[model samples]
Target: MRVARTLTAGLLAAGALFTVSGAAVADAPAGTKGQNGDPTEAGTSFRTATAVKQDQKATADGTTGDYLYWQFPAGAGQRPTAKATVKLPEASARHGAATWQLDVFDGLRRRQACAEGEQTKRVSQQDATVTLSCTLRAVRPYAERWSNDPLPGAYYIRLTVADGPDQDMGLPVHAEVEATAEDAGGKYAEGGELGAPLHAGAVSEPEDGWNGSWWSDRWLWTVGGAVLGALAAIGGYTLTRRPRRA
Candidate 1:
């Protein structure tokens, strides 16, 4: 009889779990490969782009007309952001207003749209610095080739002078670039997952292990609570029972 009661309790809990959990949901492993203190030099092209730590700042030196490039890793459910600051050589070296632009691209080399930030800024010759930023849409676990939805992969950052005075072409400049990602939560898990995380060139996985993500941590707590309740109820009934008359 006691065994029967336990089985009944188990069945009830299973039913609740099934009712609440809609489907098999997962996210691309959180986090990605990073260079850490990696490099002080920026790549001039996608072929030579330098890698940067996800949450740390990395600096590089370059000329005014150089196309500086950096790369960082991002995973599903993450909304990654990129920031770059360029310090010009000297106001006297520049001839006129110069336009600086920051661009972001996915592993597939497709440009990703920024949700916020002034990606391009036109600074006067007298201006000392140009700061630009870009906040990308939350990464999705999966997307069709035809669709442009953000997905997990190695994202690239490109900073260059879109328009500037000829005199500024070869002037020395200093640039600091940083990239970070915030947990966008698990809403994108329903999109399904990529066959493999997108990797370009020499990029490789980091220390963070790639594993399936839970649909919601709340579901685990719910299931745990229900099981505990069932066990307590069974124990209480057994202890409170009166001795049966022989």
Candidate 2:
């Protein structure tokens, strides 16, 4: 009877363990980048284009203009709901080459996709218009944008390309992203009202030896049961062999 009770207790523990393990695994995000696992409170934040890249300049070709670019985090890529622009300074006369390429980065990797206008430039202004409007949906793969990925921490945005001559015109570009933080609506540019800084706890692919996440938890519970069973057996033998007084 005692053995039966102990076995029942072990089974109950195993069940409880499975429940916890399942819950933890289920709570994990769904995507190729989040297999490793991230913390509960981890969230996304927006950074300015200048924050990612700097040093704006016009090309010597006299056909291109200054510009900036950045990649969006995977899965959380967002399409621009409204038109936005960054103020640019006066540079050498580049007739129609001044343009911006709002591209998305390859998932947590160092590759980028130029799924937008190939040659972009700000429209000629009567006054000094430093800003350029960026239409999000106008870019390719609008459905798969950074806002959709929603990683939990800091990721990089790279300057993949700037409008310039067709060839031999790979001059460095410079530009700054307008900060939308602390805006009038009590919200920031990142679309989040909290104005949170891009954090650095995003969950990515799991590293070596950690692939057995769910199974590992199950194994631990099973091993614990075996240990308890062995101990119970030893106790029963000892009690049966005990000497009795007359």
Candidate 3:
């Protein structure tokens, strides 16, 4: 009984959060300035990741090698990208070159592949700033487990030094980060219907999503598998049959 009640309460809380977030996103026009001042701090891990909205600039101070974490919401049908810059301490205080890296992860904490942009960079000690960017693949409504496709949820951004001189390890640093998404309307393949996959589960959605018709890739793969199975069956039958002898 306790377990059941706990689950129910968790689900209710999740639903409330989703509805409130959706309503807020709906009322706020895209690309509009935020009503509050910009964020000035970031978290150190996924659970504590500071929440940032799309297009908002994030600033934070930390040790050179510390991993800075921030998170932003994403919905289906949007291609999200994360960009960040690390301003190093005075060049004179450095002893050698350093390598910086930026990483983006999905709600599942899975590292996302950057379709474009310099996700890593090597900067000389004389360099004052390191620029990094990661453009992740578009988020989908639902995908097969094996596909490991990105889904709508909170995406986290991590900034850290991949390599640096010992002297730079604890040096003070400032960073700026931001996340953005593009409105790429739901597209379909030639044979697949508008929404053949038929989104059977609940999910977060972008402002301009075809919520009613969220399906495609899933059906395409299903159709492809059926074709392959038919071909294999015919091949197996041909191999098993013996040629008729007169």
Candidate 4:
């Protein structure tokens, strides 16, 4: 009886551990990038975009006509959203606040419509900064119907200062871009890599069953296997034990 109780306790402990680990894994934040550059030049691409947080610091000056670009992977049945905050220098009587614009493009360099959130904001002299965000509803597996709309692949974000001070372009501005995807609970297809001329082999694969908690899954599997082994041992012991004679 004592051995049975011990085995039961072990099983319960293993279950509790799995539950805790699963919760921790689900609450973790998604990946991000921190890239800064003048994307105004021709043929500029996100070949070397840096990994950054949902909120990151970037620089843009007037003279260079600076623009920032970031690329994120999206899978079928997933809806991606991108948000950005642009902080311009203190506004003066001579220098008005800057106007910023945020545009989202698909792997084919086609502009995507925003399903939610504002995509443009102007930072007035009174205000220090402004925010622009956009969401791309369900990225279909392939172009469907008459619309040759965007398909799942590398999504890019472009942030540019639409209007601002022409002189004294040395003033530095802060810009941040955040990207997120929500699962739509629909069937997903096998993921693939971005096509040629871009990042040669950059792939946008579907989120795995493990999400980002590979270690948690490993621990759960380990504990579960141990529980099963213990149960088997207890069963064998019970079957092998003989009843005592009076």
Per-model C-alpha RMSD: 23.3, 28.2, 14.0, 25.4
How would you encode candidate 4's per-residue C-alpha lDDT over 1-246 as one tens digit per residue?
A: 999999999999999999999876544322232245222121124543433322333333332246666666665556778887766666663266667788887766778899998887766667777889898877655544467454656677787777767872556666656777776443333234223222211434435321221232345567999999999999999999998999
Among all candidates shown, the one with the greatest lDDT: 1
Model 3, residue pairs in steric clash: none
Error of 4 at 106 (Å): 0.7
What value does the lDDT take at residue 195 in candidate 1? 75
- For each candidate, the alpha-carbon lDDT, in order, equals 0.78, 0.32, 0.76, 0.59
For each candidate, give its TM-score against the true structure.
Answer: 0.71, 0.27, 0.64, 0.54
How many residue-pair clashes does candidate 2 contain? 25
The TM-score of predicted model 3 comes to: 0.64
Worst 10 residues of 4 by lDDT: 208-217
Looking at model 1, which ten-residue stretch has the lowest summed lDDT? 24-33
**Which of the numbered candidates is closest to the native, going by highest TM-score?**
1
Question: How do the residues 1-246 of candidate 3 rate in per-residue lDDT, one tens digit apiece?
Answer: 999999999999999999999876554322222346666877776666777777879888899889888878766667888999888899999999989999998777888899989999999989999899999887776676787677667788899999988877899999999988875454612232224222212223334443223555566778999999999999999999999999
Residue 204 in model 3: lDDT: 32
Instruction: Return the lDDT, model 2, position 27.
Output: 49
Which 10 residues in a row give candidate 2 its minimum summed lDDT?
179-188
Model 4 ranges with Cα > 4 A deviation = 1-64, 92-94, 168-170, 185-206, 209-246
Candidate 2 residue lDDT tens string, 1-246: 999999999999999999999876654432222233211111121222212101112111111232232322211222221112333334353323344443333334423333333323434422232333232221111223345432322233332235434542443333333211110111111332212313322323221111111232345567998999999999999989969899
